[model samples]
Target: MAECNDLFLKFNDEIKLGSEKKKSLRKSRNAVGKDIQKYFDETLKVTKPKFWGQGSYMMNTIINPIEGEYDLDSGVYLMHLSDVEEEDWPATSTVHNWIKNAVKNRTSTPPQDKNTCIRVIYKDDYHVDLPIYIKNKDMEHPKLAHKSKGWIDSDPKELTKWFTDEVKEKSDQLKRIVRYFKAWKDFKANGDKFPSGMIFTILTANHYVEGYEENDDSAFVAVAKEIYDTLDENFSLDRPVFPKEELLEGWSETAKNNFLSKLSTLITNGQKALEEENKEEASKIWIKVFGDRLPKYTPPKEENRMDKGYALQTTEPPVLGNYGRSS
Candidate 1:
């Protein structure tokens, strides 16, 4: 237990201590993987089947880079194992023991999970929570279920290979479209709330837009524009909050105050934007705070014609029929 605690502390220091550097310490995965591999080989006296490979390089995709550091993912996998058929042997528990005892002998601090039957976690400076599970051998393999992310079992190497092959076989036109959307994410994070909302909406609607193929950058961008207009027409605000500031530098007093102020404005504006379906106005407010870089919008000719850009002015003569009207 003490060894485990020590290892956890070391990991926490490396990965979780500072926010700026806290961006997922996937680099540590190399060391961790080697250690796990060595342990597995030594204890089981059986090499991991060559066909299986490790898991994803990234855990979650980042919408805004400057806003925060990202978490990465990396893990081991076993192939040729049938998930459903393996049910005869409490497969989850069996694998969990293999990982726990293997690591325990290698590191003074063996990765330990409260329940070895379910999973064995090696909590380090960065987050390295691995879940264990067998792959269904009978059917076409599916990607790891995000909801069931904590354990191990399905061959990640197989999945990565599949994903890569699928990407290559698909038209480059679609790849370019995906890239455009990726750029849109980067741009929106910079402070273009309008594009961000539109991009998200378009990504979601792409699943349903029949005949509107997303195979090319031009096609994708066109979809983005359509979604933008649709959202603009039906836009409404709901309060939004910025993610917590968990950078490596540690939170500063000024930073905290700034976060609060920014959050308040976003919430107020978001609510107004939602009620009025004023997506443009809501986006303006959204970028004003969360955006890393301020976005520039070209005012319409009528608005730009005025020196102040465009301010609402009272043009009608003052009404006098109402009693108590100011002189």
Candidate 2:
């Protein structure tokens, strides 16, 4: 029988970011950090322009993005912006535009003024989102600057910390499972079929049952079951870090159904994999669920017993003697 563990581990490696890319990403983010500091200190003359990483990178759930696209999110917390109100401590447009101008000339296209962040699109599959934030003394809490509504309470750092702590408390196994789910999200995001990364992350954390998963293969199986194991059709996901944060608040029903449909198919395939006698065949089933990144299934070599108590690998499945015909 082929080793299921080996297959999953190999698949995980194949789907994850490579060493060269990891180095490049780190370098790029470091340069970004410097750009933020330089623009604020010299150009804007603002003090203490600090930023922290959010999303998949901080959570260690980073995976290869679908197609040739990739993205990173960073929160820029500016402490000193002049002539701002107590209600609106940090001006959203001012900060967003500053970020926009900083990276505008650098990117292939002009920096976009998103709802909360200024997105810098790269030539290749790398883009970074710099969400403007404010930490006022009066508010005493980090508030994200929203273009439409002004300030809103959003702590990506808090969320990241919560996930990190949970992965620590339970096991690293959970984090790997999270990556697998994220990969599934990226894979199925052809159109409007897939849910947002935040939605999937919330659902996974909500439904994660720690002990059931021993490793990657079992973890995938466990998570597949856990998604459908819920009794309620209208399931609501709450952030583990911030219970008040509603993940699926305005998500469309069509999107939910699409996500669930894909997840259900994965679950059904996983069930079949568990029961199948041929290990190589089971891996093929998993490959269908995961996609082409998963390795092609190869059966174990048959060991042939010969003279002198020696063993040799046969080209085909080895045949054993001791045959009895019952008529």
Candidate 3:
């Protein structure tokens, strides 16, 4: 991992700049942009140059403005060598070797070190890996576009574009989401341990639910509803959850302390309430503890009501379960 101190210091600098931080981020993204450009320029001599991930910062979407570290991502375009036969469509390894050879032959100063093996380093920093076979040079359409649910499951290049575009177009909504996530992250960091990938999945799902479009009817609301329903089915107040130590790394200590404190309070109060058979007080305390972490929805009082006489009383547990797991 990079130096945590260095990362925090840089993060602090960017946060002090206010909106200027966005521009600084744009400039940082341009480094990857230039690298992609160089890949096209260098590889075009040997193989065709197809579409590159020209979209804005992929890492910026889910990033907390307060957090300084941001990973840069850009998909490199690739094409087959003209002389290479179609019979040798190229195995994954062969395609990787082709990238190695092309990077080795570059005239411009390489972004990566010369001795760095292509396949290993390429896959590590880029986040995802795939083989793109192109016979002709065209920098227009994405390398692959798969249609789904009214929109396209297109290349991640499009996803990157969508993320940046949404940040610009739905600035207020994006800000709200950012604020929510920032708070959610802090809240989760403080005591509530959730799945490691939950936040990223939620961030991505928000865009996906919004229907991969730039319009109002994007699928986000519906997706949120579905997630809400799922969670309603699976929540249980008796369970004890601790922050997964391995996932949070640096923050694990903080999370662990938070978890222990919260868990102790929960158990102590819970046992007292149970001894008194005050389910209502116990339930309310649990809700007070974790309700904000739940999905945004008006719960139907009837579903969780203890009895018909208790219909007017809001004693039931709020929505529960793995809301972020499905959809």
Candidate 4:
């Protein structure tokens, strides 16, 4: 089998968000958050809210988009109003409108009133999603101001904590694996409809294979196969914390089928790449999975491989220890 761990690592570096881009994203998030807080203090006359990062950005698995703008999910927690009664809580739409008004005129394009959050777009090819939440002092978890569903029980902080702990207890390679999966989703979707980053994170972490810490190629193949098989059988991913709601409940059948088809192709190509002995050929197979952004394979010097007339021996596949969850 080809030794393509170095290539995989290099590809990860290329796809992940750079330090400068991350800094810019952070600046935008902080600015929007401050603007929101100022609006509450001067206009709304309510208690100031708190801000914290969430989603892939906070989890350290965020990737630079293949086409569209980068995303940063910063949550606005209305903790100061914890003394309010649940019956007296503001309506979800009213809360969303408050957030929408808070960030108006901050940018050339106005903030968007999305279904679940208010989005503030920046000119530098990035946007920040501010999801509003209310945590009453009597409640155990915060509730999101969903447009259609009203205030629903949801706690993103708990989800982030779960992913962080999983990484610490398992392998850091799991982060890379999630990024690779997201990069593939971005390339294949090409600005079209696709699964959310949260879904990919959940599935990758749940089905992660911990044994291939050193070999990303085999690890990706194994995890892809597991996800494909498991989704094919059950086709459901529930939130790991708080609400424990089914994440895919809102997905249409067409969307689920589309994701599954793409995943099948990835698994097939990845397996072929692992089986191919020629490093250059295997890298080409990977290019089919990811895009050309992945580094090309360069053949070793002739002197390094051929000794007189003897052919080089191929390396065996790494032994996989156990799955993150039972198969």
Q: TM-scores for all candidates?
A: 0.38, 0.86, 0.37, 0.89
Model 2 per-residue lDDT at 126: 88
Strongest candidate by TM-score? 4
Indicate the TM-score of model 3: 0.37
Worst 10 residues of 2 by lDDT: 318-327
lDDT of candidate 2? 0.69
lDDT of each: 0.37, 0.69, 0.36, 0.85
lDDT of 4 at 111: 90
Candidate 3, residues 1-327, lDDT tens digits: the string is: 001112222322332223555565445444433444465568554444454432223434334332324333334445444344434444444444554454443223333321211321322223112223333233334222111211111345444554566556644344333333343344445436643323333343344344322321112223333434443353212111121123224445555456445434533433342232233443344234334332222334553445656654445443222112223
Clashing pairs in 3: 209-219, 209-220, 210-218, 210-219, 210-220, 211-219, 231-320, 234-321, 235-320, 235-321
lDDT of 4 by residue, 168-227 (tens): 988899999999999898778865566688988988999998667788888888888899
Task: Between candidates 2 and 3, name the one with more favorable lDDT.
Answer: 2
As a whole number from 0 to 100, the lDDT of residue 150 in candidate 1 is 36
Steric collisions counted per model: 24, 0, 10, 0
lDDT of 1 at 231: 37
Candidate 1 lDDT, 60-164, residue by residue in tens: 112233433333344435433455453353444466666555445433455545431212233443334454434556644322322323332233444345434
lDDT of 1 at 290: 30
